[model samples]
Target chain A: MSFLIGDGMTGGYGSADILHDCTIAVEKGEIAVIVGPNGAGKSTAMKAVFGMLPLRLGHVRLEGEDITALTPQARVAKGMAFVPQTQNVFTSLTVQENLEMGAYLRRDDIRGTMEQVFDLFPILGEKRRQPAGELSGGQRQQVAVGRALMTQPSVLMLDEPTAGVSPIVMDELFDRIIEVARTGIAILMVEQNARQALNIADRGYVLVQGENRYTDTGEALLANPDVRRSFLGG
Target chain B: MVDILNALVLFSNFVLIPGLAYGAQLALGALGVTLIYAVLRFSNFAHGDLMAFGTMATILVTWWFQSMGISFGVLPTALLALPFGIAIAAVMSLFMDRAVYSFYRKKRAAPVTFVIASVGVMFILNGVVRLIIGPDDQRFADGERFIVRARDFEAWSGLSEGLALRSTQAITLVVAILIVIALFWFLNRTRMGKAMRAYSDNEDLALLSGIDPARVVMVTWIIAAALATIAGVLYGLDKSFKPFTYFQLLLPIFAAAIVGGIGNPVGAIAGGFVIAFSEVTVTYAYKRFLGHLLPENLAPDGLVQLLSTDYKFAVSFVILVVVLLFRPTGLFRGKVI
Candidate 1:
């Protein structure tokens, strides 16, 4: 069974729907990537799943249990975390404090979780006392991801993690994401780099103007001539 | 030598001691204002009236305690009633947040809208305080008036001119120091304080981190209320409790907040002193003080007051304008956003 599901999301800021009956699922221990052109509502779909945007005609489920009405904080408590595309880190807080905030809903001792996050992103550990704002772009992204991971989320959603990083850093971020997936966390990420993102995705979704045009295994979508021509820059 | 002694005494009475006390008061008040601005992302123009309300509560409680025959000896009876004032003010703040401010917050209203709403709140609170207190000045400061009278200091030092340090003024300085130390510690050491800073730094990121915005707003109001009460009560104790006096103090407080770099606590404190000293020194008549140092014919005919005493608040206003014109961020370098 899929660990997280967004079934038939249809909503936007106002009257017009940015997402129209959109469905996306992330299985346990897999990287599910969503790629689309600008104005395609990729981020909107993520927000709907995270409960940041109102759902006009859809429901989201985690492990087959409906949680469409839960607030974002409630979603965090329910073992689901979302990292937005920009300004995702508390810039004034130290690296450690940023991670500590991620575990705000948890009452237990988070030392173990902190150590685990540090293990996953060693640069964060090295600069734990430094403010998150002082870090390089790639390192800040790592801090953002590490902050979300502190909740020990079953499904970790990232919105365009590599949107503003160098090519080498983007490759490094993808490697860390693959490593996170190895720890049995369902990873749902939206990306602008369609081809590279699909290459590492266990499942790839191609969206156009808020509707899913194709859904397939990563390799299958890469080989699809139409996807290659339109999205993959043939 | 005589003129220099007189100037020093004048400086001590009007500038050094009073400036510190007033700066401390403004600092505390501005700290709360900055917190709300930082966390809530708006300038609460109602902050002055809120301080008035807190002081009004303190005045009522002090009167109650005094009537009950409870006293703190040489110390002002108002200090003993401070906690009660703080509690009531906190509750009032919570109510304001829950009833008025929260609606705007939920609507995600523009900061300017909040500013206007705060102005409305200011009027409501002003009316409420006036209705209860009768708009009259209440002298709640009882017991010894001065720690050291000028005559006594002159007798001791044989300087012909001596400082008159009021008991309330001394208390104001000591209490202000303690409050500042305690506030800094809370903001730096406590989890909720850090959460506040985080929220101020980045609101969306804070929400994403599972920090409840409502709880943070509640906490901000509570702290602001407490700080406002303390500052207002102390100001009243040092001077006199007149509701309108607090309303006037708002301009200077805002000047301090802006000068200290809005949303920056340390900046607020610095800005407070800056405004205080500027007000004192600019309007201060230096003729007498300079007379003793200069030759007989060189003695100036003017009072040497740069501006009249009535326009002291104007001094702060001028400094604020200059700061804004030159460095809009503030002298202490605060966030412009």
Candidate 2:
């Protein structure tokens, strides 16, 4: 069993099921990337793992404890942080304030964690007083990740964090994710840049229509001829 | 020099002082409206009635205080009674939220649905206030009425025009400044305040960050209730407390909020002053002041008022329309209405 797993998850937003026995798992200090074609239910699978969608059948376990009944907020208290694809940062709030809001549930000191986040993204430290909305797309993404990291979660999940940024910024974000994973936080993210995401991923799950079509080490999935020709655009 | 001095004093007497007081009242009212719009995501049509309800509570308490012979010594008893009014208003507002707004919220209703629901709430609150206070005007203000009497000012300044400063006007300005400072501090410096801002900025992100929606909504209602109560009491003190008059005030208050940028607090204050000054200056008769400024022979003219006092509310309507047409987001770039 992995450290965190959504085993055999099956559900949808409405009556129509978006996932069918989909499974995803990640261990501590490793990067797990979910990548596939458009409408492959990549984001849906991630949403299921985060408890944003109800599961008709299956269970989510964190450290062997069933958390399927918990709300999304409760999962945050259990040290899971999710960064949405859009509207991730509080546009009206300053970057520092955005990070402060992220640590709202914590009763302990979060200044050290905030400082570490600033260290991770130096530009955010410089523009801490600026409103998150005023920052460029890449800088805003950094602020979003920094805000999520303020909670010091054991698992950090990103939903296409690099969606609109330039290629250079995407690489920078990927590097930051790898660094975050190195800090012993399990990194689970959905990525559109499949080849680059797989290059840095320790484990890769290729989802097709809400079900896992291939689950392997990142290198093996990248080397596989079928994955290359069909999904990765050989 | 004497002509200029008299003209200036006349302008100050009729426009500046009254405008400031009225602006303060409208700003406070609009601040409450803007807060609800920002956090709750709806235009609360019941705000005017909420003010009336709070003022009614204050008036009853003031009467009680007078019966008990309790006074604040040169301050209106309403000031002392204000906290009770605020508490009542807060309770009422919370009850309304739970009983009415929360259901629509749970249903994921559209903004228009929330607005129509608010209109229903408005009618109910309006009837409740009229029933308790009656349709007649109520005078609860009891204090030293004038801070600067016109006769004393004329004698002191040795000018033809006399300037009078009412105690209520001074009180309104002082109270308004203090409240604004405290509000800004709360919004910027406090943990829960920032959480509220975060929630207003992005509801999903705030929830994912573990900020409770119920707690935020509760706090917003409390603060808004306090603001509405204070604004109502102050306005009643400045003029008179008539339930109908308070209901009529909704137009100007909404104008202020929309002109300032619907969900922006700073914009509310700016919008308030803009509307108040426009209404005051446009309706003011400039005949005497112009006579002082011009030569004696050239003073043969009618009352030079641009608009009648009956058309005062129309000024707000015009400004609201112009703002909506040119910059729907408001002067400070607030959320588009």
Report the C-alpha lDDT of model 2 over A7-92, residue by residue, as the tens digit: 99999999999999999999999999999999999999999999999999999999999999999999999999999999999999
| DockQ comparisons of all candidates to the true complex | 0.71, 0.97
Give the alpha carbon lDDT tens digit for every residue of B197-299 in model 1: 8888888888877788778888889889998999898899888888898888888888888898898889988887888788878887888777766888999
Give the CAPRI rating of model 2: high
lDDT of 1 at A33: 95
Lowest summed lDDT across 10 adjacent residues in model 2 chain B is found at B328-337
Candidate lDDT (C-alpha), each: 0.88, 0.95
Name the docking class for model 1: medium
**Candidate 1 docking DockQ:** 0.71
Q: Tens digits of per-residue lDDT for model 2 on B1-337? A: 9999999999999999999999999999999999999999999999999999999999999999999999989988999999999999999999999999999999989888999999999999999998888989888889799999999999999998999999999999999999999999999999999999999989999999999999999999999999999999999999999998998899999999999998999999999999999999999999999999999999948999999999999999999999999999999888753
User: Which residue segments of model 1 deviate by more than 4 Å?
Assistant: B1-10
Kindly list the per-residue Cα lDDT of model 1 for residues A79-149, writing each as its tens digit: 99889889999887899889888888778999999999998889899999999999999999999999999
